[model samples]
Target: MDKKLIEELKLKLLEEKKDLEKILKGFAKKDPHTPGGWRANVPKYDGGHMEEESDEVEHYQNLLSQEASLENRLKEIEEALDKIQTGKYGICENCGKEIEIGRLKTYPAAKTCLRCK
Candidate 1:
């Protein structure tokens, strides 16, 4: 990839990383015991109300799944930024071929080319 394009992708990845972190922070807490890990904050219901408690549990489950997905994407973006710093960005992880510029523009965190994907 061209230097200018790589710079643009780097900026995009950085912005995405910041945005994901902000969103995850809203309903999840970073796991200090485990680096790069986050746990959804399960809201506590008062008086042991069964219905409210069940709803809270369900909401927690949904947040957990969303947090996991966002965390994974953040990791991918971080890795892609690292690859760019190491002069290995835009390379397909599966076949070691150059990824399409258009695809990279759409997903700066992509690790695989369209063919590999």
Candidate 2:
């Protein structure tokens, strides 16, 4: 892999990591007890308004789902960054081959090449 391309991908991954953290911070709190863990904020219930409370619960559930997804993507980005430091950034984890430059450009965190994928 070209050093310039890997540098570009590293920047891209860093930018993506920043964006994911911003979105997760909006509705989720970082878990102080667990590194890289996030907890979705539960909607506060007031006066036990049954129907409104139910809607709030549903919205909270949706936020939880989104939080999980964003966390996973953040993890992937972190792993990719680690690989970059180790000089394994563009290598496919599945087949031990160089990942296509185009695929790396499209998804810098990809672990497998197109064939392995």
Candidate 3:
């Protein structure tokens, strides 16, 4: 891969990481127990109506799902950045082939080529 192209992808991955962290911070906190882990904030409980409590539980569940998704994406971005450092960016992990430039441009965090994916 061209050094310049790799640099561009690295920037994209960094930007994505920042954006994901920002979104996660809105409703989640970093988990000190696990590196790169996030925990969705549980809604506060008070002496309230049963219906309201149910709604809060539902919302908390939704947040948990979203947090998991965002964290997975962030992990992929981090892995891609590490690959860049190791001079293995843009190579498909499954097939050991060069990933299509277009695919990499579309998703810098991609781990597999379109075929493998």
Candidate 4:
């Protein structure tokens, strides 16, 4: 892969990582004991109305799901950046083939090429 292209991808991945962390911080708290882990904020029921409590629970579940998804994607991006640093980026993890440049541009964290995927 071209050095310039790899640099560009690194920038994109960093930007995305920042955005994911920001979004996750909104309704979830980063786990102090676990790296890259987030826990959804649980609203205190405090003998509140049952209906409102149920709604809060549902909202918390949705935030937890989204946080998990974003965390996974961030992990992938971090892995891809590591590969780039180790001079192993743009290689398909499944078949050990070179990934197309266009595909890499579209998805900087792709682990496999289109055929392998």
Candidate 5:
């Protein structure tokens, strides 16, 4: 892989990591007990109004779903950044082959090459 390409991918991954963290912070709280972990904030309801309670619960559920998805993506990005540091980025984890440059450009965190995927 070209050094320039690797550098570009690193920049892309860093930018993506920043964006993911920003999005996660909007609807989730960082768990103090867990490293790089987050939890969706539960909606608070007042006066025990049944309808309002249900609405709040529904909103909480939606946020939880989004949080899980974002957390997984963030993890992958972190792993990719780590691999870069170890001089192992852009290799397909499943096949030990170089991942296509186009794929790396499209998804810097990809763990598999086109054939392995």
Candidate 6:
């Protein structure tokens, strides 16, 4: 793989990592005990209306789901970055073949080629 292309992918991954963390922080806090862990903020009871309380609960549940999804994507991006460091970037993990450049450009965190995926 070309060094320039790898560098471009690295930049894309880093930018995405930043964006994901920012989005997660809007509704979740970083977990101190585990690396790259996020805990969605729980809605607190302020003795408001019952309807409001229920709405808050529903929002909290949605945040939890979003947090899980973002965390998983972050992990995949981190893994891809690690592969780049180890000189394994662009190789499909499932088939040990070079991933298509177009696919990698579209999804820098991809773990497998289109066929394997």
Among all candidates shown, the one with the greatest TM-score: 3
| lDDT tens digits by residue: candidate 6, 91-111 | 998999999999999999999
Q: Model 3 — TM-score against the truth?
A: 0.96
Order of quality (TM-score):
3, 2, 6, 5, 1, 4
Q: Which tens-of-lDDT digit does each residue in 1-117 have in candidate 4?
A: 789999999999999989988998888888877566877788778888889889988987887778779889989988998998899999999999999888998999999999998
Q: Candidate 5, residues 26-84: lDDT per residue as tens digits?
A: 98888967554997777777869798888888988898888888889999999999999
C-alpha local distance difference test of each model: 0.89, 0.91, 0.93, 0.88, 0.90, 0.93
Model 2: ten consecutive residues of lowest lDDT: 32-41
lDDT string, candidate 3, 1-117, tens digits: 999999999999999999999999999999977655998887999969999999999999999889889999999999999999999989999999999999999999999999999
Steric clashes per prediction: 0, 0, 0, 0, 0, 0
lDDT of 1 by residue, 5-103 (tens): 999989999999999999999988888675568888878778687888888889888987898899899889989989998999999999999999999
User: Between prediction 3 and prediction 5, which has the larger TM-score?
Assistant: 3
What shift in Å separates residue 6 of candidate 3 from its native position after superposition? 0.7
> TM-scores, in order shown?
0.93, 0.95, 0.96, 0.92, 0.93, 0.94
Q: Give the distance in Å from residue 11's predicted Cα in candidate 1 to where it truly belongs.
A: 0.4
Off by over 4 Å in 1: none
* lDDT, candidate 1, at 92: 95
